[model samples]
Structure formats: C-alpha cells, structure tokens
Target: MAPAIRVEIEKKHIDEAIERARTGVSKEESYYYGDRLTSGLQLRVQGRQAFWALKYYNFTKTIGYAYPAEDKHLPSVSAARKLAAACKDILDDDPKMLEPMLVKYYGGADRDVKKAKKEMVAVSTGWTVEETAEAMIAARTKPDTDDPIKKSTVAQFRLTLRRPQVKALSKKPIADVTKADLDAVKREMEKSPEGASMIKKFVSDIRSILTWGATHATDMTSLDPSNIWWELVKSGKKKRAITRSPIVDDIVKTLILAESYLERPLPGRFSEGKFGVGHNVLNALWWLALSAQRTTAGTRLRLVDFFPDPKRLGSGWYLAFWAEGETKNGKAFVLPVPPRAAGFLQERMAKAKRNGDSQWCFPSSQARGKIEIDIPVDRNSPGGVTERMAVRDYPTKDKIAKELAKNAKWESPYVDLLAENDIMYWSPHDVRRTIVEVLEEHGIPGGASAVLAHEVRLTDDLLFVDNARNREQYLELRVSRVTKLAYGAGGFIPLKSKAMEVWTNTLIDRYEELHSTYRQARKKAQAERVLKAIYSDANSAAEAKEAAYLELPKIRRKLEDNLTGHKQMLSGLLKKTPPPDAGVRTARIEIELAQADLDAFNTDPASYAIEPSRRAASRTHSAVLQSALKTDEKPVDLVVEAPAYTQLRDQFIADKIDVHTFRLLITERYPITLDMMDDRIITGMVTGDEAL
Candidate 1:
C-alpha cells in the first residue's frame, strides 16, 4: 500500500504533489493525498501521472487527471473543488447512488467487493434510465408554463430514447450511466442515415430529457442537471445541410392557382385507405405558406383570433393574433397578411359562421362532398398535417421511418397536389423559408423576420445601430422594430403587408401591368419627340394651309399640317375614351409629355412651318431683311443651339429665372412657354445632383 496524507486541494499543493510524484518515487509505487478542502475527493499522485478521484462507500474511482490542466479533459483546481463538494454531498446522503457510478468508471472491483455489490444491488435498486425518461415525458404533458412542450417534441423524444443503443443504456440503473455509455449512444446516433440535423435533434432532445429528469424525476433526485457527465458527448462539428430545395416563386403561384382549377379526385391512386383529404387540409397548408407560420399555431388558428377590422383599421387589410406561448418566439404577435390571403380567410370565416362551425375556421371533412361542421381539420391536431399534406399531394419517406406511430397512415397521392405542380418532395417548413428568402431578396427585410414571428436580432438592426451615429442610412430596407418604436405592433402591419405584396407581385408569372406601365412611359417620351419632328418637318406645310390662313392666329397659321393635326386627333381620342380607364390615363400621360415639346416648338421662331408653295421665297425675303438690318456684326455660324442658352446667364443675374430653370435652359439646351415654366422647373429640379 502507498502512504496517504491530507492536504489543501489547491494549485500550489497539487504542484508540490506533482513534483513528489515525478521525483523520489519508484515506477510501481503511488501516493494518495486526501483533499483537506473536500470530504470525498482525493489526489492519487503516481510516479508516471496524477489523478483526481473520489473515495466513497469502501471504493475509490478515478474521475480525471490532475496535471497540465489535464489538456481540457479534466477540470482545473477550481472546478475540481466544486465537483469534490458535490461528491461529498452525494456520499454523505446517498452513497449507494455512487456505487454503480464507480463500477462504470473503474470497472469491476475485487471478488469480495463484487460479492458486496451483489448484496447492495439487491437492496438499493432505483428506477432505470428508461423509467426516468418516461416520467420526464409524463410531466411534460402537464405543462408548467404557458409555453408547453410540443406533443411532436414529446413524441420525438420518445422515439430517440427508444433507440437500441439508447435502450440498452436506458434499461440500466440511472446511476450506472457512465460517460462511456453516453458516448456510445452518441456514436449510435451518428450511424443513423437520417443525417446530421436529425442526429443533432436526437442528441439535443435526449440531453434535454436527461437534464429535466435529473431535477424533476423522483428516482433521478441525486443527479445534478447542470453537472451531468454527458456534457462531454457532442453532436459533432458538422454544420447541418439545408435539406429542402428552393422552389421558384412563379411555380409556387402556379401551384396556388392550380388548387382552384385542378379537381383533386377522391378515392384516387394517391388516396390510399379512407375517402381522401378535403379542402381544409390544403387550406391549412396554404395558410402555412402564405403566413410563413409554423404548422402548429398556424393550423390551429381560430376564426376569432383573426381580426378582419382590427381597431376598425380597414376593410381590405386584416390583423391576426397568435396568443403568447403559441408561437415559437413565445410572444403574442399581431400579424398582417396580403390582401388575397386576408380575402380568402375572411370568406372562409364568413362561411364557417354561416355553417355554425364552432371555432375552427377549417373543420374536419374527408368526404368528397361538402364538409361536416363542428370539428377541427381531418386531424384533431397539427402534428401530422405536413406529412398528410405531403402524402396526399406530395409523397415523403417519413412513412418508412419507425418513429411515426402509424405505418403509412392513409396513403394517397391526390394528383393535383405538389407533385403535379412539379415540387413533389415538398416541406411546409421550407415553404416558409422560401417566402422569407424571397422577401429578403426583394428589399422587404422585416418580412423575413416578421414572417416567422422571430425576435429582431437581424443584421438590419446591427446596421441600423452602427449607422445611427454616422447619420447615414446603411440600408434601404423594410420598416423593422428599429424604425417602429412609437407605432408598436400596429406599425408592422403595413410593412408586412408590403412584404406580402412584393412577394405576390414576384409570384405573378407575367407582370403585364408592370410591363404596360414601362412601355407607356417610353411611348409618352417618344410620342412627344415625334410630334416635335413633325412640327419642324418641311413637308408638313400643306396647300390647304394658305386657304385656312385667312381666319387663323399667327402661331396657328404656321402650324400648317402635321403636329397641329395630330394634336387635334389626340384631343378627339381623349373625348371618345371613357373616363378613369387606361385609355384616358394613356391619353393624359401623352398629352402631359408633349407639353414641353409643343411649348418649345412655339418658342423657337424657326420652328414655324411656312406655306409650301412660297416657302423658298419667304426664307429668301427673311434672309434679305436680316442682311439689310445688320450693323458692324460679324457673320454668325449656323448654330442650332436653343436661343435660351445665350440669354439665361443674364436672366439668372437679373433674378428673372431660378436655379432649376437656369440649369434646364443651360443643360437641356431648350426653353419652354411661360404657361408650362413652373411645372418644367419642378420636374427638372430633380436632376440637380452633385458628387460630394
């Protein structure tokens, strides 16, 4: 036997012990230093190495190493003191709890201790790990807070605990579960073909249960929730891959539109057993896609929770509520959806009220005909709505997974579902992600966070805070919490509404209105230019113009044929087209666009057309008059530049024109009639930009 002594368990004492351990010691010998600071912890300083162990119930077990800070494998002096304290408490109150723990760490004891263990096991048996987990699950069913554990979570938790490797460990006494056993469970999870994300969730769920059981379960009283040795078991460092594929927005719109057109035949090839899923199922899925809400709270939405005229806000828009604890963020959210989504929801709610359906807007209806009233959707809960929707519209491999209770529950492939829409293997969760990404891409940033009802930890907020001091806008984005402190929840409505509008607009396969608007703008500008060309054209002075000159004004006398005639035609069309239509709007835009062209035409003296027969004679007479009137002036170049440019500098000095008009005359190289000058200045002023 080696010598044993008591000493303060500090770094200095440990360093001294390490020195003694390395020097003046035989390789075969070992020394034991009992911790003076803690009751059960001791330092085993051997010739080759040192260890931290706990002595309790006639057996001592090596828990960790003692030197070189144990290469992060073992706790340091401060952490070891805390662990030693916990061990002291466990040993003083329930030493047997540490018995299996020691056996697991140090392996089987000598024959005498093993025989004693048999007797000890017979008397002090506790609940198995499986029992502790079940108890934890049962406690979860009765929620302690408003934020209750989801049924799907509990179900998934059950599935993870029941795995073969986990099962074998779970069957053992809770106290016997060693670091190695937990590590083995992690390896088994890693072997699963379900991929890293699923494996990650499995480890996380099991870890939560283990932690909850340590504090909550009766048989797991002695275990520390925070200090469980399973903390060493990691889910690996691999980042989870994005499993669901991105869908084209136009394809998504087509899918939504197809729902109204495609008749999902009942008792079809995809519909396996019972009649088939009804419209309610599809509606729930659509709501998820439109709202970007989780399946649980979204599918369970009651009609009353939807406020069509919140605070008497408006008719076309709406405000929706999900109570606190219902959402993943655990905050009550008042959401606003697009007009189309709101319209559909209102129509459904109105129909439900007429049908005397209790609360759920979408009731159970598996029949091919009209749905039955007074119950929720075909499923009582939101648990398998995604899977059922996938099966009916899109097929999934989930039915083959052993975790699900049913073996392919009521299989059906309603032909007009997601597959017919070309996104066959769809995830409703990814649908939420898809829309959020679209909104972020299209400049409505808040819609991304607001869709999932997420907290505002976005990079937008960071930029806002960072740029606030610089007094510069870092982003031209959506109205988020940073911009809406005074408006509160109501402010998000319009922002989210705009986001949905942008999303829906993007979803349109052919944006005819947008194209029409662009084309109209181009034609308006082009029409004005064409009119100017016609006004100045030599061929426009008709033989008929000289006859009409008897009763005409001088400007009208010069406007012999083309633009003057086209203006008459434009006026005629404006009279024939009905008011408030695209035709009237188009006529008005063209007329407005031609204002400057007409004014500039009338202002320039040379733009006037002359009678065709005498045009050469009239120009020769004008040239003779100008030559006779010249006095000591040099001959000028044939300048086509507008006369306004030569006089605007003097006009500006005299305060006869403001900055914009000055720029317009100098830069645009043109002038307008007095009547249109104000409008021209206002429109032209927008161009006065300078580099800082």
Candidate 2:
C-alpha cells in the first residue's frame, strides 16, 4: 500500500481553519494551508498524492461537495482521502471510538450488568412512585390539630338547613339566590299560616349557612361575594318592608266554615287522617288556642295528663302532671287543673276506654305501638303508686300544638263561651293567659304567674303573698262554684239534668228498638245458614247413592260381556281347530258391547252416576241474593234516628235541653230534625246554645 499521508495540526489551528472555512475564506490563506504544506514536504511518504487529493476534495466540498470528474483513477483516490478525513475527525472528538475495535479484538461478549444494577436498586427500596405521591398529599392537606369546629353546632346548622321548605329552596346554586326567590318562598308559606313561623326560622337558617360558606369554605375563592348569603341578608335589610298579620277573625271563621263542611263524616273531615281543611282539626286548634299552649300540645292531649280528682280543692279538677319532654321548657310543669278540664278529660277517657284503647287514650290510627300515656307517679306521695300508668297516649306535644294553631275555632270559641273576651293573638298560650287574668280579677296576686307557670319570685310583698296563697284557695273555691254552676249540688247531676234525662231515655228506647231489629236480622241469618248446611249434607248423600247405583250397572255389564267372550273362546280352543276367525269375532263382539255402553252413557249422563248440581247452585244463588238485598237496605237510617231519641231523652233528664243541644245532637248524629219539635223550647233548653 502507498505510504499513508500524515499531517500534524494543533487543536487551535484546526479550530481557526474551520472558522475561516465557515466564513467563506479560501483555505490556502488559512492556518490549515501552511500546516498542510510543511507536513506534506517533511512526510514525503505520500508526497503530492495526499496534498493534491485532499486539496481538490476540500475545494469541491467548500460550498457543496461533488464526486471527482468521472475519471476512474482520480475518483477512487478522492473517495479514500475523504473517508480518512472523516475517521480522523471522529477519533479526535472521542477516544472511545477505539472501544468497538478493542471489543472485536477481545471476542465480543454479552453481560447482564445494566439490568442487574437496576434490579438491585429496586429490591433495596420497595416503595413505588404512586405510594410516594399519596404520602406527599396526606402530609399537605390533613388537619393539624384535634380542636376543630364543635360537632353539636355543626349538627344544628345541618338540621336548620334540612327543613322541607329550606331543602327545596337550597337545591339551587348559592350564588344565584336572590330576594325574589325568598319572597316567592314566603308567598308559598302564606298558603299555610300555621307554618309561617317555621318557614321564617328556616329562612334565617339558610341565610346563616350561606354566610358561613362564604366566609369559611375552602373553595370560597371560586364563589362571588355578591352572591353570598350575607349579601342577600344585607340587601334584604336595606329593602325592609312590613308584613301584616292575618285577620284573626277571618281565620277563625274559615276554621268554622271548615267544621261545617266536615259535618258529613269523620273520614270526610280529613283525608288520610291528615288535618285537611276541616272541622275536627280546627276544633283541636281551637282547644290549643284556648289553652294558651301550642296547637300540637292541645290537640295531642292524653287522658293520663289530666289527673282529675272530683274532690280536689281547686276547680274540682287537677292537671297534676305532664311529661318533661312535652313541655315548651322541656321540664315537667304541674298544672292546677280546673273542673272543666277534668270533666273534659274524664269524658274523653271513658270514651277511649270503651273503644278498647284504655292503654292509649289518644292513639293515632296510623301509628301502632306508639302509645303515648306514661305518667310519672310521685313515689313519695302518701297514696302515690310507683308504677307509671299508660292510661292514654297521644302524639308529641309539638305536633299537637302545631295542628291546634291551625284550628278553625281558635278565635271565636272563647269569645262565644266567655264574655269580655277582648283579646288579640289568641293561641293555646291564651288559655293560660285567661286563667291568669281571671285569677288577678279575683284579687289572687301570684295566681297569674304561678298557675301560668311563669317565672316569678315570692317575696314578702302583698302581691307575692297573694300569689302564693291565691292559686290554692282560688282553685278550691272556683272548682266548687263552677261545679255548682255546671252540675248543681252534689256535683253529680249536671246543670242540664232535665235535658240529659230526656235525651238518655229517648236514646235507650231507640237503642232497644235497634237491638230488636238487629236480633231479628241475626236470627234470619242463622236460620239461612242452618238450612244451607242441611241442604249441602243431603245433596252429598244423594250424590254418593247415585254414584254407587250407576257403578254397579257398569260392572255387571262388563262382567257379562267378558263371560260370553270366554265361552266362545273356550269352544274354539276345545275343538282343536282353527275356528273360522274366532279370535276376531270375539274381539268384534267385545268392541260392540263397549260401544253400546258408551252410547248409553253419552245419551244420558245421569245414568252414568253424575250427581245433579242444579239444586246446590240454585241454593247458593238464592242465599247470596238474600244477603245482598239485606246489605243494600238502609242501615244508617236506624242509627241516625237513635241518636235524636237519645238526645231528646238526655235533654228531658237534664232540664237544660235547647235548640242548640238539638242542633248539636242532630249535627253530630242524626244531622236532621223532626218538624214537630218547637224551635223556641229546644233553643231555651240548651245551656251553651246562646253562648255559641
């Protein structure tokens, strides 16, 4: 091989030459030209061959590279020189370029070094990338300490938001809420005035929640401050407007109207036992209003709550106990029961006991096992019983009070019953107020606060002394007085004794007639049942007899036919001859006998032992028709007539029966009047008729 060309060039000189070439200067004027000339002369091994070839290659590739002018010798020479120059540049930049050649010399071998290193690291540390990420997040966001917001306050806030009306309104985004929306909700509440207070509370609660969220929510930055609940509250306050209370008279009248509508039937008064717009609920509401307690509490009163002692000192009645949980203050408050209250409780209790509800005096029809009565007995008392009694159970006090607030006669019931009834905002609390007013009127100083369960201190003042003694003395005197006024001497015969007697006699007579009619009906039903049983037994026996008779004939005919076939078969076989188609003939005779039997059965099925079914069917149809007709008759007519007679008899006995009593009795039971009864006598006879 020709001696390889060698050129010594400094690193700086090569960099200078490359820069000059990049700048478009002629290579001959650069540092590389002088170095190339000196090296070419000293190393004469390749002489002008390397110099001319490299120079020509560099010249052609300066602007753009090209193959040598197609001449065979020059082209090969130029290609070799170019290859050598590229190798030199690579060797100069990286000494490791010689590693592959060294590996080739050493007989190239495979190794697991890289993979082993990775596995070693992985085994040493078990944590994955995801576990690390999760740990980091936990460290950043977790609460730092235990003393956070109180759970009870949070629960209250949640409950406040959970009201039905609040929940419905809160479904929208908090930001979009407006006063118009609140007004709309208020308007909806107007439809149920009884629920207005609850609605107001609910609105206030929602505003609080919004304000809390705006101030403390972690994501509050995304919320607009203007849309916050606090903003709504402030805006509302700025645009304050007065709202008028509904006319109490109109509301009371509406309640009365509802009662008039409910005079049809008990179920008619309320659909699904829910106090719809009706009299029963309204009446309960009136009681609540008069009692000066929540409507729900009054309406849900239980017989057990009233400890009526006919011999008690005050009002001949005593509401000695009430449940702690049921009171507004959530503490058991003793009531100085009045005679009127005691009478009402006793009457209700008797009625409930008669109806098989002695355990629950005011049990709801829908809720079973929710018996309300559970009176705490004073174990230390002289004659107290330790065991709590469940004389009657009623709904929770809150529920009863709520229902009463919406009652129909809330306004007029007291006005009509008592004179000088100038009062506003009449409610169950007003009943307590009335008691207080009456006590004060009678010069009983502390009577107002004590009987009303109001917080008051008993000092040495005259008023205080009066308050201390008046409740007890006044209650005793009033009980006797009212008792005499209502039921006369002995407190047994009602003041309306004559009227009650007449009503009772009439009722007894009518009831006797009804009992007679019912007995007759029952006897008729028993006779029909007995007749049906006898007929059924007879029909069964007749069917069995017919079946036995028909079965015997069928068996006899089959036996006779079989015997004749056997005789023919035996004759042919005894003759030891192929008796001319004897087997076939026997078969034909058997088939013909069977056909005849079938034809007889088909022509008259009764002959085949089927029992006649018409008699039983006819009897059943007749019984059903008779029972239906009896049911269709007017059953209510007798019941209706009986109540009037009872009222008339009661009126006669009490000597206080009047048109109002008659009207009430008729409205409650008969709901109709006879033309013969005089309006004036009936009107005069009733005690509360004029008052109502």
List, residue by residue over 1-692, the lDDT tens digit for candidate 1: 37678777777767776777556457557677787767767877776567788776686766567653433234356656665555555567666555543333334343233333344432236667777777777776773432247666878877877777577876777755667776677777677686466667766876776676676764554566667776666778487666674565433543353344324433243445432334566566556666767776677666655554343356566555555565676655556656666775565444432234345666554323332335556433332443343443223444334333354344323333443445445555666667777887888777777556644322222211223454333322222322432136434656767776676555432322234454465445433332222222212223223322332355544444434555675677667636346655666666555665566655743323222223432343344334333434432221122233324433443345654665445434422222222433212212212110
lDDT of 2 by residue, 1-692 (tens): 33333555344433443344344433243222222433221111111121222333123212111122222121222333433354344345543342332223223233222332222211112222222222323432346522234344445545545555555555554544557767666666556655556455556655655554454442532334455644444212232243323233422332333344333422222332343223223334433433434433444454444444454445464543334455556543344444544454444334431223323334433333422432211111101000001101122234435555677233211112111222122323334444444445446535445433522221211111123446577445533443332233322232222222232233223333345454465554443333332223222333343434446566557656665666676566556665557665765676577666656655654433322222333333454334424555432221133333433433422334544564455434322222224331121122221211
Candidate 2 displacement at residue 343 in angstroms: 3.3
Q: What range of 10 consecutive residues in model 2 has the weakest lDDT sum?
A: 382-391
* Index of the highest-TM-score prediction: 1
lDDT of 1 at 464: 14
Q: State the lDDT at 397 in candidate 1.
A: 45
User: What C-alpha lDDT does candidate 1 achieve relative to the native structure?
Assistant: 0.52
- Candidate 2 regions off by >4 Å? 1-255, 261-286, 295-301, 310-315, 323-326, 344-355, 358-361, 367-448, 454-692
